[model samples]
Target: MIGLEVSGGIWKATINRPEKANSLTAAMLTELAEIAERAGHEGARALVLTGAGRVFSAGADLEEAHAGLATNPVWERLSGAIAALPCLTIAALNGTVAGGAMGMVLACDLRVMVAGGKVFYPVMKLGFLPQPSDVPRLRSLVGPSRAAMILMAGQKITAEEAMSWGLIDRVVDAEALPDTVHALAADSVGASPAHATAIKRMIWA
Candidate 1:
């Protein structure tokens, strides 16, 4: 499930199904894409994507994934929506991030992760490849060598390692994650929305 709320010039989208480690289902991915689109149309100055509990997301729900179906198209659309948002986008990684969920994280303009959290892409081990859109995004964040290491070598990166590798911008205590993200969002409130949007467009252009 996905939960969306807008306040203080920020649109927050939370992955609320903690019971299953917030694994994304087809319906949830659709909701996320819609939320991202709505946030842009609603004039949000910033967007934050995060999970409700200790795990950011375990990636696509295996059940749905194995049922002669593919959610990659929807997932790609969601990632594209986040990347194409005119406003700033931040991924608040309150917990572990794994598998296809890494695409969404990389699509964000910035990322703040909880200390001790882990990030891994298991596509290699699972006998698949990262989505076409995801490969370049990940490569851009950490460079080709490191990206290969993550994608081909199946390395599991820690929060500290992720920051060092340029996969995330900040790592904070779990308890401070929300406050830190809120502070970052609040600090951006003073910027001219037009200027911010322009800069974002140019950066991603």
Candidate 2:
């Protein structure tokens, strides 16, 4: 359930399984990782990760998680691929982000969410550890204490709270999400890949 569109040096990947809250499966995660990896080599100046429904992702599909997807290396591969991209990466969070899905979202250089979207990782409750690389990124964005509030206390943070805590970069209504993402991506998309990469590294640095 992954859809990708490439135009004018911008790559937009969408998770298309909204019926199950866009929960990811092994194949879907693999495709996402492949897309991220390809974007790095395919001259993409900007890459946007987004979902196709009311929820970005409820994380891994429950059945698949029970069948060993919980500890799959693909999760790390996907997040790492996105993290290693030289071009700018943006997570256009269409809705709530939960569980293992937090990995890819946190790996992005920028995050913009729709209004009323919530963010949480229920690893403690679900008996699965958070994805390896996700921890430090999460900690970096929201700080140790707030990260503890979500990862340790299993707190569900709303979009507004996430913004104040430094998690979400921008929050806008659903209708405005596309425009917001487009605006954020325009400059990067228009630049050469190497130019965009250099600026991204400087900002990230």
Candidate 3:
């Protein structure tokens, strides 16, 4: 399930599926789009993407992945909306983030990964390649060499290493992650909404 919580000017969308490591199903992706649209139009200044389990997200459920690619197309549409969100989008990586989950992280303007967690985008293992637009974002976050290693070599980096590689803006203990993210989101909202929106549009463009 996907859940939305609006508090203190932050719109947080959480992936709730602890039993399945928060792996996203098709429905959840659609719900994400709906939440993003509503929050964007509602004039939210910040957004936090997270999960309600030990793992942030394991990416697409393997059984549903092919159908998602062919029939549903939820992944593309929802992720695109996230990337184009008018506000500052923060990814609070409380736990493991992998596979298709990496796309969502890349969509965010900033990412914070918890200690001991890991993140890897292994689209090559699925016999596919990431879309062209994702390439630049990944490069901007981690530089071309590390991005190439992730996509081409499929290297899975620990959160500490990911922080060192610049994939994540900060690394913190799991217990402290939420508060830290909330504080960051609050700071983002302190800026003029118009300026933030313009900057977001330009950066994503």
Candidate 4:
């Protein structure tokens, strides 16, 4: 399941299947694109992507991924939707993020992780390589050495480590994540809208 909330200038997109660690089904992915598209015109200055349960996302629905119809193009469409979002895109990584889940975080402009949460990249294990389209962002975030480790070794890095390595902007107590993201969004709104948009455009460009 996927959920969307637009309130107080903060547009939140959440993964709603805590029972399944917020895994992404095909329907969920389609909803993600729709939510993002809707947020585009909602006068939202900041967008927060989060999860309903302990885990941010366990990654793509494994069953869906294995079904062979979850084609690369579908993933690209979702990725494009996220990448094209105009407002500040913030990821509140509440827990373990893996595989395609990691891609969602990478698509965002900023990411905040819970102190003990983790991130994993396992594309190689599944006999595939990193998406060429996503490689640039991943490389810029962690540099070649760390990106190689994630892509080649499929290692899982703790949230604390992620902060230190610059993979995530901040690490907060698990319970504090929502408030932290709220504060961040509010801070964005506190800035000049013109300047904020300009800065965001420059950063994204």
Candidate 5:
């Protein structure tokens, strides 16, 4: 499921399914979309998406997939909401990210990952394609060549490689992750909220 907490102008959303490696279900995706919408309406200065345990997310739940539950629409809605939030948004990747979860990571305005964490896209291996919206976003962040490496080659990009490719903003030791994200949130909270929102919208436009 999704866990939400708001304090000091920062909203945090955590995927709380450690036993399953935080693999998202239909209900979880719905809750996440609602949380993202609420964060916007409540005028939080910053929003952070992370996982409860070591794995950020294992992506869509295969069990749900077998049950004919299509997660694409809900996932799209959630990621879109995160991307369109007026305030700054961050994906504090506490650990590895894989599959459809990469869309959520890419949607964030900035990303900070643990040094040993990795990002793996299994599109080619699984015989699936990246979402239409996700393709351009990934391409814009890391360019077409790297995007190809991820989508076509099914590459597992290490934190250092991801940082060098411009996919992630920062990489820090696991123990420093929380403090780093807190400092970033504090800085965003100190900025002029209205200006930050306007600039973010303008840049996206």
Candidate 6:
């Protein structure tokens, strides 16, 4: 399940099926994409993607992955929608992130993770190619070799390592995570929609 909260020009979308390690289903992916699209169209100044539990996501749902979810186009749609948003988008990594779940994280303008969180993408081991845009986005953040280390060798990296590698922008205590996100979002949320979007465009340009 996905939960969305919008207030004061900020849109927060939470992946809520923590019992499943927040793993996504096709329907969930579709809903996330729709929410991202709506955030863009509805003049949100900031958008935060986060999970409801200790683990951000373990990637696609196991049962669904076995049934062709691994290669689904919905992954691309969701990430692309997030990437296209003019709002300041952040992936507030509540905890570990693995497999296809990293696609949306990579699309974000910033990634802030809990101090002990881990990140890994095991497409090579799983025999599935990542979403189309994910490759370049990931390489841009963490560089080619490090990206290869995760994708090819399936090496799991800690939050500090990910931050040093440039994949994660910040690593903070779990208790401080919400305040950190709010502070990072404050200026944009307080700005005029056009002003915030213009600055975001300039930064991404």
Q: lDDT per prediction?
A: 0.88, 0.94, 0.83, 0.81, 0.88, 0.94
Candidate 1 wrong stretches, greater than 4 Å: 68-71
Selected candidate, larger TM-score, 3 vs 4: 4
CA RMSD per model (angstroms): 1.3, 0.8, 2.0, 1.6, 1.4, 0.8
Q: What TM-score would every model get versus the actual structure?
A: 0.95, 0.98, 0.91, 0.93, 0.95, 0.98
* 24-44 per-residue lDDT for model 6 (tens digits): 999999999999999988888
State which candidate, 5 or 6, has the greater lDDT. 6
Better of 1 and 4 by TM-score: 1
**Tens digit of per-residue lDDT, candidate 4, span 27-142:** 88878877777777566678789998789998778888888524555556666667777777899988888877776688888899888899887888887666556677788988
- How far off is residue 61 in model 1, in Å? 0.4
The runs of at least 3 residues in candidate 4 whose Cα sits more than 4 Å from the true structure, single-residue gaps closed, are none
State the lDDT of candidate 2 residue by residue for 1-205, as single tens digits: 8999998788999999999999999999999999999998877888999999899999999999999999999999999999999988999999999999999999999999999999999999999988889999999999999999999999999999999999999999999998998899898888876788888889878
Encode model 5's per-residue lDDT on 51-120: one tens digit a residue: 9989999888888854643335877898899988999899999999998888888999999999899998
Deviating ranges (above 4 Å) for candidate 3: 68-72, 199-205
Give the higher-lDDT candidate: 1 or 2. 2
Candidate 2 accuracy as TM-score: 0.98
Runs in model 6 lying further than 4 Å from the true structure: none
lDDT of 4 at 193: 62
Q: After aligning candidate 2 to the native by TM-score, how far in Å is the CA of 40 from where it should be?
A: 0.8
Error of 4 at 20 (Å): 1.2
Better of 1 and 2 by TM-score: 2
Off by over 4 Å in 2: none
Steric clashes per prediction: 0, 0, 0, 0, 0, 0
Model 4: lDDT of residue 164: 78
